[model samples]
Target chain A: MSNARRIIVINPNSTPEVTSAMRDALDDRFLCLDIPEGPATIVTDRDVAEAGPRVAALAAAQEAPLAVIVACFSDPGVAETRAAVPCPVIGIQEAGVAAALALAPRFGIIALSELPIARHRVRLERMGMLERLADEVGLSGVSAYAAGHDPAVYDELLAAGRRLIASGAGAIVLGCGGFGPRRAVLQAALGVPIVDPVLAAAGVALSVTGGQR
Target chain B: MSNARRIIVINPNSTPEVTSAMRDALDDRFLCLDIPEGPATIVTDRDVAEAGPRVAALAAAQEAPLAVIVACFSDPGVAETRAAVPCPVIGIQEAGVAAALALAPRFGIIALSELPIARHRVRLERMGMLERLADEVGLSGVSAYAAGHDPAVYDELLAAGRRLIASGAGAIVLGCGGFGPRRAVLQAALGVPIVDPVLAAAGVALSVTGGQR
Candidate 1:
């Protein structure tokens, strides 16, 4: 209840289910917004690039947001949104990566699918955190489109998690925002830290939520 | 309450007030331990190195700890404690740094004293996080010995916070666990994200706690 400041988590995909999942994971302070004009889901660099301005537009329209969390793993419009808004605009991938760093020396990320792997690499490079990354593995069949509603996705996540650990990852970061609630499950199964980006953003949100403007 | 796993926050310092401050900032899941054999305050690299094995010994003696948080800002014994403990051993400096990364591209640290600057640089280099730090400034006179008991320390912290911001820090990390309770005040005064090192470790604690061994 103390996380009672106004923070908007904009899911720049047309999936209401993803929005619902985010709402379930976050508290009342976080208003999860689903863009009707967005792509089915963001996966490839193309999807991420296309989703950028649409997300930025929606983010620009929000009234007095203390902070905005770009909830997509590909982080569409995160840079543009920050310029558009008066407050901080955080990306889930960056938040999850930071959470991973907090836990271990070498961390791995499990993405929804292999398509966004390139995008993540670029973001990691920009953040200067690429050196600490052990590796990033993607689920073979779990697309970002179905990630929100699929309980079956957990199996794929667990399998990828095993490979990440075997690859020398000390902690695992769930790169997709759709993997929000399954963080504990992965942590228990993998016996290492599992970072849920949405949840990770909450700590940053709590720190700066009143208003930086 | 979901951070229900047993996590021990070990303050490798002789000051009980610092331990008490940690307990207040954290929840019941975090059992704060004040080491009687440690230095009254850890500032210099000598203080950090000396406290290492002593904190490691205390950590080794604890039974069934899900994770151990080396709650000192200097993070004494963190490496040694990790080797001695079966579960995760997180240091507040690393956690605070990661929390800073979550909020912004570049961050700053406000330490208890200038003596720990060299030690922090060594640790930051080891973690591969030195580049992300905008700056690390220490309060002129505050010691870990009196940090826990001084409500008056807020003024000193605010002054340092301004300097860090001016030096291009996007967020301010309370480098000392002794600065845990004053996070909100600093955040408000500085108009930037304020990280409480003790609290930052909790999110990492939650992800990996309840037995990573």
Candidate 2:
């Protein structure tokens, strides 16, 4: 069973609390990997630069992967890692957006902070899906490190979810891997689908890996 | 049980055989309703225009619905229906594309003929996702009415699937409702995830409507 082909979801940030929260958030069906080399925290574009090569290198070194997920919403090294691996390399943001699109015509994003909001925009634009983003809000001062563990992040996310729905987002995406645990409770409050990016990527991975072929 | 909230998957075209096949292709969880007023078959842009308002009116009149699906590959009237409906209104083309994005970076679409191929391009262009399309191929002479019952349509689809894989499609989408039943079989032969547009839309509906909100 240990040798069974697995989907590896790499949490690129090196902060232990962040990694631990992400590991707990992900389903047991996937292998949650925390790299020893990326930036200790991804608070800015500079941190994303520091994390990309480490993620690419880490993913390239994996064995028997059915798929790999770049768990950061910024998707720092997903493109590079895709070419380096034989299996599908899914980015959390893209997977989440895809799922959100299925749930509703337009979607909103809940980013841990401003940097990832910009990152999400860039990636969506590149994928030609920026138009589908109804709106995006960032938790003020809540870094990815804090988002991973602090329950205090709840109220801010809920308030933002209301505003996003008011802005015409039929569904919302938890844009940080750290926000994965908050999806269900938030969706219940928001009364719309709340997509957890890591879980969304895992679902996509499972669809591809569920069968032997 | 009879009055349970349902997802309405409207086949949009009025041809009886087409409706029958789509009913067979859809999982029982959804209610597949073929319109009495759209074009007899959707082959050209004129048919799309004729089908659009009929789809909108039919969708608006539905009762106790969790979601509505515009099941035609051309997605006639999806935008109009979305505006008319209180719940999620899913179009098969957009849903299929979203599922394909989850499976891989680029996807190929299999259309029934030259006309639906054109409609697919226009819609993808409107969505700003035209760039992500690897390629699209159509069965040379098959019409939607014939496609629904004819098993002989298999070989052309298989040949097209091979070329699409060669053209760099990591996944292939069955772009018409009639193509839905062939999905699992063709996917086995092609070695990639084959997206059935109706089923893809259904998955999204379930995500949004699965729980009573």
Give the Å error, residue A53, model 2. Answer: 4.9
Candidate 2: where are CA atoms >4 Å away? Answer: A1-8, A13-41, A46-65, A101-106, A143-151, A165-170, A191-193, A206-213, B1-8, B13-41, B46-63, B103-105, B143-152, B165-170, B184-193, B206-213
Report the CAPRI category for model 2: acceptable
Cα-based lDDT for every prediction: 0.78, 0.77
Which residue pairs show backbone clashes in model 1?
none
Q: Which segments of model 1 are wrong by more than 4 Å?
A: A1-4, A148-152, A207-213, B1-4, B148-152, B207-213
Q: Write the per-residue lDDT of candidate 1 for residues A122-197, one digit (tens) a residue.
A: 8899888899999999777575545545678878888889999998898888887777667777777888777777
Report the lDDT tens digits of candidate 2 across residue range A19-56: 67666754555678887676666778887887788888
Question: What lDDT tens digits, residue by residue, belong to model 2 across residues B3-72?
Answer: 8888898888877677776666555567888987666668888988888898989999999577898988
TM-score of chain A of each: 0.92, 0.93
Which candidate comes out best when scored by lDDT? Answer: 1
lDDT of 2: 0.77
- Judge the docking of candidate 1 as incorrect, acceptable, medium or high: acceptable
Listed in order, the DockQ scores are: 0.36, 0.25
- Residue-level lDDT of model 1, residues B107-164, one tens digit each, is 9988887878888898889888899889988787687745645767777888888888
